[model samples]
Target: MSKRKPQPPPKTFSVRPKRSLRHTLPFGLLLILILAAFSFTSYESYASLYDADYVGVEVCADCHTIMYDRWKDSPHANMTHQPSPETVVGDFNDSSWMLPPEGQLLPYDDELPAMRTFTEGADFYMALRRPGTADFTSFKIAYVIGYQYRQTYLTLEEGGSLAPPPPAMVYRTARVLPLLEPPREQHPHSRRFVGANDHPQFGVEPVLCPVPHHQLRHSGP
Candidate 1:
């Protein structure tokens, strides 16, 4: 045989690394962190329902039907409403009322009293002249207070202030609020000297006027 070049010895490959935790440690830690994050997120999501204690007024209707029926129509039910055609009972079709709508209209700088101006188109507004200001500022009526006897308006103002009342003549330094008034009447009578116990109009009800709560619950009254 021709002197063949000596073949290089067969090269040997290194054995595969052992299947140990060291190689997969990073992946295991990542998986554990992901699981922990999911658990914490789930816990936080489910723990948020403890905010309000009452279920709602609807739930109370089940056991207190009479109370619900009476309450549903009472003035208390109409205590607050949004100012709209459905709730507002005032005349707002370019109608004007004197500033002291209860009294005579006074002469303002523009010959129109600083007291009154409002219009109703798509919305209602109170165009009133602030005491010191020369011009009138238009305030948008945001809410209606009641609908039983009469309705009053709440206006939104700058800086989220609650209007107290329409400035009759002067605006108070305190926070403003909605202008509302209950219908009131007073009849003056001659004063007569009388004993304390002789108070006729000041009738007193016994300490327990209405029946006890438990009795009311059992009986329909």
Candidate 2:
């Protein structure tokens, strides 16, 4: 019997640990998802501060009909808008006045040539005299802010040579602000203007106007 050449010692076999594709794939996907979410949130936060960039209320009305209907006529809805016959509440017809320069608040004075404000055709205009000289310049009203307790009209800061009229041409500078309360009764000797009056328009003045408190609640993230 030819002794079968000692069958080479049963060939030794070795097994090595293998990495799981399932475990690695899911972890990589989770990392990618987290990165995408972070990028989107950061961009949204940066775009909200610009007022001119604000998507007008009309854009928001599509999905929120009921709320939009309620807000359409609400004071907050009219907070700021272009000047128009329908939107203007002031009695421009019978109430044109030569208002004192923006800073000279209160009782219409007789000392200087007051600034004249009234409606002309379709637009409102203010005839303002240049300080020291007699150059009367007329400015058109551009925007109106607030309508409930007070309605303040604003002129553009630098739309033209008449812009930034005098003191400063800041966005909120008031061209005219109608008083909510009727004129106060005048007393002899103590000549104080009755009712509400236009305050000074400042370039960097800090003025706080009233807004509906509930409107803030409606704003969502």
Candidate 3:
């Protein structure tokens, strides 16, 4: 008897599922690695820009050897120094000069000139009359600037420091010297007379390079 041919084995079929992104890759782990790389690079870049402290040239030497080499022997590097026998070139031998009063040239009339004295001893000093007072205050020599032509002296400010440029910078050459809190020297070419400037701005314009490393020049001698 044919017995329905054993029901033809129930006609079964097998199907294979398609692979997806989550199955082929460690999707979460891959995403985490990408984010970590990005964060590490970003942190390094930003951290270097905002740190505003003088870490010194040696600190930068390792990373920027070329720049450090160019700057180390530059005039800016040797521009300023603590006063010593070797650094000071001025004739600070108790020398005295009868400078013009405040902001005028050598008095052709009845004005008494300001008196400046340079003394050298255990410690060098520059004695000059302070403004609004009749007494002369002796300020110790704190620093010396470069000597391309002449040496300039810098004394300590009110707090015994060279910061904020207290009547410090005594330029070596000038016709008139104002013994003011901030001296305004004049270099008027006219030998006959040089009047006091209403808006005096002949010398350094109150700008100071307190930072050891002044702005560097990348090109040109």
Candidate 4:
């Protein structure tokens, strides 16, 4: 009986199989996370290229009111303003001065001496001349006014119906003008002359600080 019971127990055997997850949830979630990370990285790389508009100071004011208000009162912001009896600072009615005509020497010769003079006009006007053409045949001062160096000169395009100066004459004299002496550095109160590089400290350099800030230097070969 013992031998038969042992043989019967030995014949009955049970086997348990390994359990495995058949769902693709974990793998799918990992793939989604990887795709999301790649998309975020790509977006950051191309952000600058998408911003192409020239958002001036006015646009910045919309978001940063306080900062814009401070900048508005700054000297840099008030560079451009209407020339009124109060806002106008230069001597508009001062004596007229002679400016060398095109292709003429600075010192002025007896024959072809100073052929042009800058005089005060009845109203503000900008003097515009085409490049290479000394004959300022066509002139119009309607809507443009700008500042060159420290002097205030109106644009010829803003005169509307107001008559323009002669081909050689760029402006009119509100009154008789006197000749100005050549600017000297020691004076410290010299009137500005266009294209004059006399004073290394003053002129356009100190006035226009931002221009030289990022001026590109050319490398010689």
RMSD of each: 19.3, 13.6, 12.6, 14.2
Which lDDT tens digits does candidate 4 get at residues 56-109? 557778889998798767655554334454444343342233333543443333
Instruction: Return whichever of 2 and 3 wins on TM-score.
Output: 2
Candidate 3: C-alpha lDDT: 0.49
The TM-score that candidate 2 achieves is 0.42
Residues 26-123, model 2: lDDT tens digits: 99999999999998877744435654365656776789998878877765555655678876665555333454465455443444554555687889
Clashing pairs for predicted structure model 1, backbone only: 99-115, 162-176, 163-176, 163-177, 164-176, 164-177
Measured with C-alpha atoms, the lDDT of residue 164 in candidate 3 is 17
- Most TM-score-accurate candidate: 1
Highest-scoring model, lDDT: 3
Give every collision pair in model 2: 184-194, 184-195
- Residues 134-206, candidate 3: write the lDDT tens digits: 5676767766666444455665555334531223333445222222321233211111111112112212122
By summed lDDT, the worst window of 10 consecutive residues in model 3 runs over 187-196
Clash numbers, per candidate: 6, 2, 0, 18
- Candidate 4, run of 10 with poorest lDDT: 209-218
Candidates' C-alpha lDDT: 0.47, 0.48, 0.49, 0.36
Best-to-worst order by lDDT is 3, 2, 1, 4
